[model samples]
Target: MSSHSTGTGKHHPVPKRYALLFACCLLLAIALLADFLWASSSNLSSSSHSSLNLSLDSSNEVVAVSVSTPPQPRSIKKKKEPKAVNRELMYLNATYADIPAPHWDWEEMPEAPVPRLDGFAIQLQNLFYVFAGYGSIDHVHSHVDIFNFTSNTWVGRFDMPKEMANSHLGMATDGRYIYAISGQYGPQCRKPTNRNFVLDTKTKQWSELPSLPVPRYAPATQLWRGRLHVMGGSKEDRHEPGLEHWSLAVKNGKALEAEWRVEVPISRGGPHRACIVANDKLLVIGGQEGDFMAKPGSPIFKCSRRHEVVYTDVYMLDDGNQWKQLPPMPKPNSHIESAWVIVNNSIIIVGGTTEKHPITKKMILVGEVFRFNLDNLEWSVIGRMPFRMKTTLVGFWDGWLYFTSGQRDRGPSDPSPKRVVGSTWRTKLHL
Candidate 1:
């Protein structure tokens, strides 16, 4: 058995080179397996990093879209706040809050048939009548024009009595009869006439009345307490202010008294004043102390420029012989004899001549619409006219305020008197 074991061991130990080759082949196989495993791990890590980067990019895009979407709604909220403040300013007085806010816009109406200034307008029923006034240059018109409210047109015109005074006339109406009192008979500062007459509007016939002992220019005439009362005007010289007050009894377009009876004199004497009887109290407001006069020997009757005292003094007559001073106007105003109307228990005075320019010393026209509250006795400026003017004829009918036939200014900036216009304007009043 010993001899067989030694021979088998000796036969197997024949080739050392084959053994070395087998060992090298095993090492190579192990190295190749380890490299394959390492490659697989690296690839997996790279794939995970790429997926994480794509997810982060998607999140960033979502965040950008959310941050850019809100400014449109914020801009729409800032545009709705100014209209509420304007409505409150329209009614200046808190006491007038109960009254509806006046919403009005001026509209043009049919022009008057004749353009005149310093004329008197009377409204009776549906008809509006315009009497004599100063025309172009030095011409005075005695023409009477009638406007029909129903037709919205000037329906008829007629000639005044030859004896009737032309310019600076004192006029009053008792619904059916219009009484024309003393005034400057002819144009260009002539002596005033003592003639007095009454016209029956229905008959269109004029009847002569007892003449005034003293002729006056632009007197304050009104029917009060069954009598035609006249007060405060310029004298026949057309420069002196008269304080004489007279009255005459009348009934049904006929004079009950043959002559006017003298009464209490006015506190102030002036021409181109507004005379109104409200609540049985006669009031005289706004006038000038002096007037334009003709040059002494000019054949054409050239008006001489003179210093005038424009005043805002207001007087009230409660009894037949007593006078009391009331609140003066907000500003000095004149030439407003027919530029006023009574509405809602308030007297509204429109365009007139105001104080001269402080610097230029030129005559200034008023553009503001003034209100005198009869109940409160306070004055406030309500509105502004489209153009400054003087001697405008004002009327109120069916909640509409009408003004026509005034001397307008040259332009908005220029307050100087330029031209006379017959253009009628109307605005609906809420109060």
Candidate 2:
């Protein structure tokens, strides 16, 4: 019927057409795949692995995959360790449980008496300088007692023109001058110190400056970002406590005088307001809002742990000027004394008071040294203090932790227990 069609072939040209169509389709698919592979290869080179997958139906054995990629396996390159700004603290070297040079020896006094009464310590020229705090809790001290490390002796420094003591006065150093601001003579002081002054350790002179916007005592003053942060102390209000956080400009040779402005509401902010300029942030620790805020006029409340009446908590300031609460002190101490030093980026709390009553309890010591890591917000017990003592003032100097004599009401029920310790001890630990 046709031109003698080939064996088993009906319209052979149709098969030829189909073969040609299949070839072109296959060619088109190959071109598209090439483009896809080119684009994907660069992407894959940057990734951990490289591969391509496709399925095929070869019933007729005419259509089949023809990929030409040579298989290649992947390997990972090692990563580089990044650089750090501050010195690294390796915990394994957790060295230094500084006991007194002689544990059994309690000297009537140390060799060089630390020239300090109630004065706050300021670090200048790598040594601590004591400015006007009460020579005794009962006396007002107007003299500046400077402790020289190079000489390892005490020198009566020039006086702060506007000398302050016993007042909730705060001291802060800008690596050059020590600023002594607002405090009163007594804890019951009803009036705020309008007196604010700066002691230029460089020139050995005291200069008076503009006073605080409002008078407050027990304020936490610290130097942060080249500015001074003076935050939350008690300002007398009728029923509620006055609460606010402020930051100030403390630069020299300025057109105008130094001034402060409200930054945040301390009540709802980070770190309940035991702020220190540690790890480059305003670290606010354990705070409350009651008579503990005792506006010098109001009765000052003493320490009470179970009182749970006050907010016993801690918080840290983040980069965005935000607050993050930390795991609170296992047992909160109303005061920062011999215990609770921020060293090696860990809070070292040792030899604090756990007892509320002086007459009955007889110095219940919180001797455990709790080291807190700011990074993980974890607490660990390092060691115990040589003795469980409170009223202890702690300072860090040249790889040593030195604290002035700490004395508590030793004997219970003695209206005036004559147990005042006048000794200085340095820790053997080099943090």
Question: Best TM-score goes to which candidate?
Answer: 1
lDDT of 2 by residue, 1-431 (tens): 66676667645345687889999999999999999998688666646443454544656444535454444445754566654421221111111112222232222214324333334566565466655543443445566656555555555556556445444466677777877767664432234564677777777866776767876655666767766666665564311344567666776512143566667655432111345667776666643343323333335422222221234367666572666777876554433422345677876654444423322322243444556687677766555444554444555656665555344433332212233353556565443
Backbone clash tally for model 2? 7
Residues forming the 10-long window of minimal summed lDDT in candidate 2: 89-98
Total clashes for model 1: 0
Q: Name every residue pair that clashes in candidate 1.
A: none
Error of 2 at 51 (Å): 89
Per-residue accuracy of model 1 over 1-431 as CA lDDT, tens digit each: 56566644566564889999999999999999999999778766655543212222544552322222222343476556667544333322221111222334788889998888878888897788988887875788998998876667889998899989987888888889999999887777777888998999999999999998888989988888889989889987788899999999988899999989999999989899998888988899999887888789988777787777888899998888798999988778899998988899999998788766544556778877888999989987777677778888888888888888979988865777889888888787654
Instruction: Report lDDT per candidate.
Output: 0.82, 0.51
Give the residue spans of candidate 2 off by over 4 A.
1-118, 163-165, 186-190, 237-241, 252-258, 268-274, 287-312, 337-342, 349-368, 386-391, 405-421
Q: How many residue pairs clash in each candidate?
A: 0, 7
